[model samples]
Target: MNETIGNIKSRRSIRAFKQEQIKDEELQLILEAGLYAPSAHNQQSWHFTVIQNKEILDDLNESSKEAGKIFNDKYIQQLSNNEKFHTFYHAPTAVIISGKKDSLMPFADCAAATQNMLVAAQSIGIGSCWIGLVSLVFNGEKAKKYQDKLGIPEGYQPYHAVALGYKKVKSTKAFARKENTVNYIR
Candidate 1:
């Protein structure tokens, strides 16, 4: 297989991370890869906020806890008890992907950008996890502080976030794909 194809096939979601932080140069490359993702009508309405400060990361975790409180679900309540259950998964660096409020293709565009970042991270031996919990807090008052602190503008909303760091363990097993999910036109 081609190197690029191998990287794509080997990429996996890493929830466990090493304590070491990702280098600035490598992080920039990952962000640049995300920026190169295709956008609808070339709107390129996505904005990425790279967070490296531990203080801000802790605050974001607190906000996630607050947001989880609004839900009556038992599982959500349980999440609050897990001190390590941060929206950014305690990674040394987090990249928040935000999109314009009025864009119809915001979610799609942001998703592509995030995937690009993930693949780029994997290719460089860095681990990344796509975090949706932060986006869940986007509409609530609890997220306002994070939005402001992260420099997300008024007209933008966070759609997704990626936690980047060194992987603690590497899994060699490929995931088993479920059948009946795809339909062929031919």
Candidate 2:
């Protein structure tokens, strides 16, 4: 298989990460890949907020878990109650992906960008995890405060996040695929 295909097949969600920060240049390459992701109507309405500060990450984690405590989903509530669970898995760097509120297909656009970043990180031997749980905090009572503090555009809504750092343990094997999930029209 080609390198791209190999990378795609091998990429896994890394839950454990080293405390060391990834190089700024590597982070840039990952973000650049996100910037290159396709968007609907060429509307690249995504914004990335990179946070390396431990204090902020801790605060966000705590807030997200607190918000998750009352979530309608039982799984989320359980995660919230589990003191061992961290939304970002304690990665040294966390990026919040936001989308413009008025843009068409903002969620999809941001999602594409997020995937691009993930693939790019994998290709470059970096560890990454897509962090959807962080949204609980952004959607909660302190949303406005975080939006302002994170410098998210006034008209944008935070959608997803990715936690990035050096890997504590590298993952080379892909999980087994579910059979018959794809169909070809041809």
Q: What is the lDDT of residue 51 in candidate 1?
A: 89
For residues 1-186, what per-residue lDDT tens digits would candidate 2 score against the true structure? 999998788889999999989999999999999999999999999999999999999999999999999989999999899999988999999989999989999999999999999999999999999998888777888999999988998998899999999999878588778999999998
- Backbone clashes in model 2, listed as residue pairs: none
TM-score, model 1 to reference: 0.91
**Per-structure clash totals for the candidates:** 0, 0
TM-score of each: 0.91, 0.96
- The best candidate by lDDT is 2
In candidate 1, how many Å is residue 21 off? Answer: 1.6
Best by the TM-score measure:
2
What is candidate 2's CA lDDT for residue 1? 91
Residue ranges of candidate 1 with Cα displaced over 4 Å: 72-77
lDDT of 1 by residue, 1-186 (tens): 898898888988887888788899999999999999999888888999998988888888787777776766778778866776776767899999999878779889999999999999989999998987777678787567767877898889999999999988884567888889989898
| Candidate 2 local Cα displacement, residue 122, angstroms | 0.5
